[model samples]
Every structure is written in C-alpha cells, then in structure tokens.
Target: MPLVTSRRFFELGDTVWARWYSARKETWELGTIKEKVGSKMYKIFIIKYEATCIRHIDQLLKFTGNDNSLKINNTDNVESRNFQSLPLLPSMPVNAPLSEPSVSNLRSSTIVEQPVNTDAIDHGNGEEWGDYSAQDSVGDSTKIPEASDSPEASENGVEQP
Candidate 1:
C-alpha cells in the first residue's frame, strides 16, 4: 500500500497541545479536539484562551501524558517556571462520602457576658441623647405633606386664579 498523506489523526474530545503563532510570539497551548473539519483539519477548543479555532494536523500534538518536553509550562518565563513533574493526587475520591465530625471533637466554651462602659464614649456636646427604640423609628415614618387644593397664600395682594 502507498503512503497516505491526508489522514484523520485526532478524535473528538481528545486532549492536545496546539501550536499558536501570533505577530509577536509562537506558543503551544493545551486544548481538546472539538470537531473534524476535514480529513487533516480539525476545530479545537483552546483551554487557555477559552476560544475555538480550526487547526491543521501539523499544528496539533496528541497529549498522551508521556511527552514531558512538549507539555506547555503555563508561564511566559521559562527560567522561573517551577512546577511539580507529576500532578497532585487527592487522598480520597471527590464522590466519596464525607464522615460527620463527632460531638467529642467539638470544643465547648462558656460565653462570658462583659459589662458595657458608657463613660468611655465621648458625647460631642454635654447634652445626653435619649435612647431611640423601635417605636421611635416607626413614628419617624410620617405621611408626607401634599399640595393643598386651596389657592396659594401670597404675602403680596396679587392672587393667582
């Protein structure tokens, strides 16, 4: 059989590192193959940029978790890029049921009531203000004065009809 130049390499939902070239720089960003546009072309959803774009087979690299060199460092400065080689594994599975904390584990404490020192407060003026209770707040919301239907009272003798 002869060598096939055009072939489908990536499948839908396959994680890949896509090569993105801009006017200023060229960087490889992690993404997943969303759709197969052509035999060798595919539409991928970029994870870093949160965008979808069409890419050729040459622009795509399958992320099989083996090629450590090809993996993007998620940082601009390569010298200062410090990250663990392996991903952190959780002690327990996320869907696992959580155990309730027992009453013995909880600490019991007595709430001490402190006396208020009103003398420390500086009342701007020598006059002492009366305590405003719930009743005082309710009484403050009085009916607003509306314009009277009667003719306007004027200091001058000139009256409006």
Candidate 2:
C-alpha cells in the first residue's frame, strides 16, 4: 500500500508542537511543519527529535512501541493518537504575561552623560556674553553721575563728553 501522510498536533505542557514524519523510519523527531493558509504565509516550528543515530532510532521505536513494518501500516494513526495525548499533559501557568517582556526593571538602567562645564566660557574681551551678566550693560551705567553735566577732567586717554 502507498504511504500516507497526515497532520498531527502534540501538546508539550501548555505549548503545542506539530509535525509530520514517517513511523517506518523507526524513529521520528519533532520536525518543522509549514501550512499554506493564503498567498503569503510564514511560521516556524522546531524539531525536538532526530533518528539518524542508532541510539535515537532505538529510543523512537521504544516511544512509539512499534517496529518498522508495523509503523508503515499505522504511521498516520499513531501520529493522530500522539496529537490527542498533548492536551492531557499538565501545563503550568505562565507567570508573566506574553505582552510584557518581563524586563520592565531594565528600562531605567541607562546611564546619562552630562556636560561637566555647562557655564559659558569668557572670551576675555572685557565683555561678558550670554544671558544675565554684569558686563552686558553699556554707556557708562557703572559710573556715578559727576557733580556737573559738563565734561570732567579727561582721564586714562578717554575723551570727555
């Protein structure tokens, strides 16, 4: 008889693992399964078992309780039974919500770099720049009014006016 292939679902705790493999191979591992839903489809599944080695082959036969000849006859049915047994397995509750990545405490762990000398530098032209400084005022604001409005004695080579 021609070999038949079918879809099978297995439950590993709370998660579901699906695969399609021939039992005749004497061992089967969880291999990836791809389904075409529409024009564009994408999904990833992990294979949890491999039977290329003699040890693995023995292990697989032990798990399925079937030899190569028997496997060829009931490969599809065996897979179906394996799928149904998944839900019966006890699944632990997920402590953290899937939407939350469980790393909220790490969000504020970044280091901030601050400029050490934030104050403006003085160019030393006797004029102070930037907001709020004593040197910013001009036109004799620093000198007291002389006794007379007329020009006083010229000092320091400054022209009196």
Candidate 3:
C-alpha cells in the first residue's frame, strides 16, 4: 500500500516532494513541500519547474530512497511518526564506522615565501583599482537612474522644466 492520504499530516520543515499542476503550463511538475497549509494542501517550492502552486496532500508523495513515494489518502489527521527526519546527507559521513583520518601520521613541509601578488598589476589608465580613494579611482561606473520627481513621468522626449 502507498503512504499517501488526505489524512497525511506534515509538520513544518518536513521535507516532501509533490506534483504541482499549472494552468498556464498544462503540465505537472515535481516540487518540495516547504509548508503545510490547511488539512489537505501544501505550499511547494519547485525549482526549475515552469510553475509552482499549492498542492493537495494526495498530490504529495514521500521521498523514498529512490526519490519517490506513493500518495494514497486524504483527511485532516494526526502527524506522522513513521517519517523521522534524518540529516540531509553530510558532505563527509560523521557516523560512518571508518576511523577519522589521522593527521599525526602524515608529513608536512613549512611553506616559507614572499607574498606573491597573482592579481593583475595595474599599469594605470585608472582601470585596475585597489586600495584607492573614490577620488583616485577612475572607470565607467554603472549608473542607475533615479525615479523622476515629476508627478507625470514621460517615456518620450518631452522635456519638463
């Protein structure tokens, strides 16, 4: 039997992958459940999907080891204890049985050298700027135009005094 139902209860931070339907898209997309809304619906954040929207509990499935689960039922109900959050996989396995790498057994060499500036050396022309005051720096800076003060703004060449 699949583990999906309207009665399925998801708590905050409970991670779930669900199918989302889009009217404009005419397609269903997979998304993660970020919030549980009401009894049977959820707010899903779908990355790379054309559209994301509120989905029913039935539309949501458990993210099993293979990355999918079966949705089965629907009802307002108690939270599920079957699903306990395991830490999202660690970059390095802390709990794995392997012994930690021993640095004491490793060899090292002391690095002694003058500081090298790999960065481009400024030949001047005010292009390569570093550790300089605003007055000392020179370049074509991006300028963001501020909002016009006039109550009526013009898109065309209408000059206002």
Candidate 4:
C-alpha cells in the first residue's frame, strides 16, 4: 500500500511556484508568499516579474530545496493548518435603511441666503403684479382679459360694463 500526502496550504514567506499564463502558454514562476488574503488564497511576490499578485492554493506549488532543514516530512495524520479568513472588504450593514438628510441638517452655517429684492424685480411688459399668493380670476389683469374689454367689442355692439 502506498501512502499519499497532501500539502493543503502554504505559510506566509514560503517560496512557491505560482502559475502564470502568457500568450496561451502556461508557465510556472518563483514567488514568495506575502499574505494570506482569503481562504485558500495568498498574495505572492513574483521574483522574476517584480510584481505581487493574488493566487489560490491550487495555483501554487511549494518549493522544497536540497537542504533537509527546509523539507517538511510527510505524515499520514498531517492536517491542513486552519487560517483565519480575512474580509476583502469592510462589512456593511446588510439591511441598513437609507434616508434623505433633513432640510435643517442639509443647510450649512457658512451659507447665508441673501434676502431677495422682490420690489426691484421687473414683472416684464408693464403688466399688473401681485403677491406670491395671487391667482387668476375674471377681472385679474394677469388673466387673459375677456374679449368684452377689447375696443373691437364696442364695434360689435357688445356693451362695455
């Protein structure tokens, strides 16, 4: 019976061969593990490329040297080390309620709104002006004057009130 040993994870700072793809060809590059970014994932610094990249455990192969000190002895009971899974992004409240800022809260203390010069504002075309609450009625100048007020109305024998 042959014994099979599996190296499930690599430690930070361990030298490993990282898989690289170039022009449809798969190549292996030497890299040093720099960080454990996620479950079964690591950040490695590729020596040849002088660049750091994230890779999964399946993409990395541990480098064992002739020095006996660097070799990890395989054991039948060997288990993979448990690593804490770091969050890639800050956790946000899943069901946080969104709201519009109140008018008072939105107003800035530095912004002082100047009083509008309502009296100096021209309503245009010498027309009668009224307060903001003004509305159109039968006699209101702002309303289109009824045809009864026209000089042509007198010619038509329509009595002017």
Model 3 worst lDDT window (10 residues): 92-101
List residue ranges in candidate 1 displaced over 4 A.
Answer: 4-8, 66-161
Query: Any idea what lDDT model 1 has?
Result: 0.60
**Ranking, TM-score, top scorer first:** 1, 4, 3, 2
Cα lDDT tens digits, model 4, 43-136, are 9987656789999887776665432223233331112211111112254212111232235544335867999878756588444344332343
Task: Predict model 3's lDDT versus the native.
Answer: 0.48
lDDT of 3 by residue, 1-161 (tens): 88865455676544455544333222223356677777787887654343457887755555443333422234312132123222234542212112322456556689989886645456566555455544545435744454553445556444654
Show model 2 residue runs off by greater than 4 Å: 1-14, 25-42, 50-85, 88-161
lDDT (C-alpha, whole model) for all candidates: 0.60, 0.32, 0.48, 0.60
* Count of backbone clashes, every candidate in sequence: 0, 1, 9, 0
Q: Write the per-residue lDDT of candidate 2 for residues 1-161, one digit (tens) a residue.
A: 98985333322221223222332222223222233332322232323332221121112111232222222222343332242222222443211111212343334457899886545666676465555465455444677656454345344444556
Query: Residue 1's C-alpha lDDT in candidate 3?
Result: 88
Superposed model 3: Cα runs more than 4 Å off: 1-7, 22-28, 66-161
Which wins on lDDT, candidate 1 or candidate 3?
1
TM-score of model 1 vs. true structure: 0.39
Error of 3 at 102 (Å): 51
Q: TM per model?
A: 0.39, 0.15, 0.30, 0.37
Q: After superposition, how far is residue 99 of candidate 3 from its true place, in Å?
A: 42
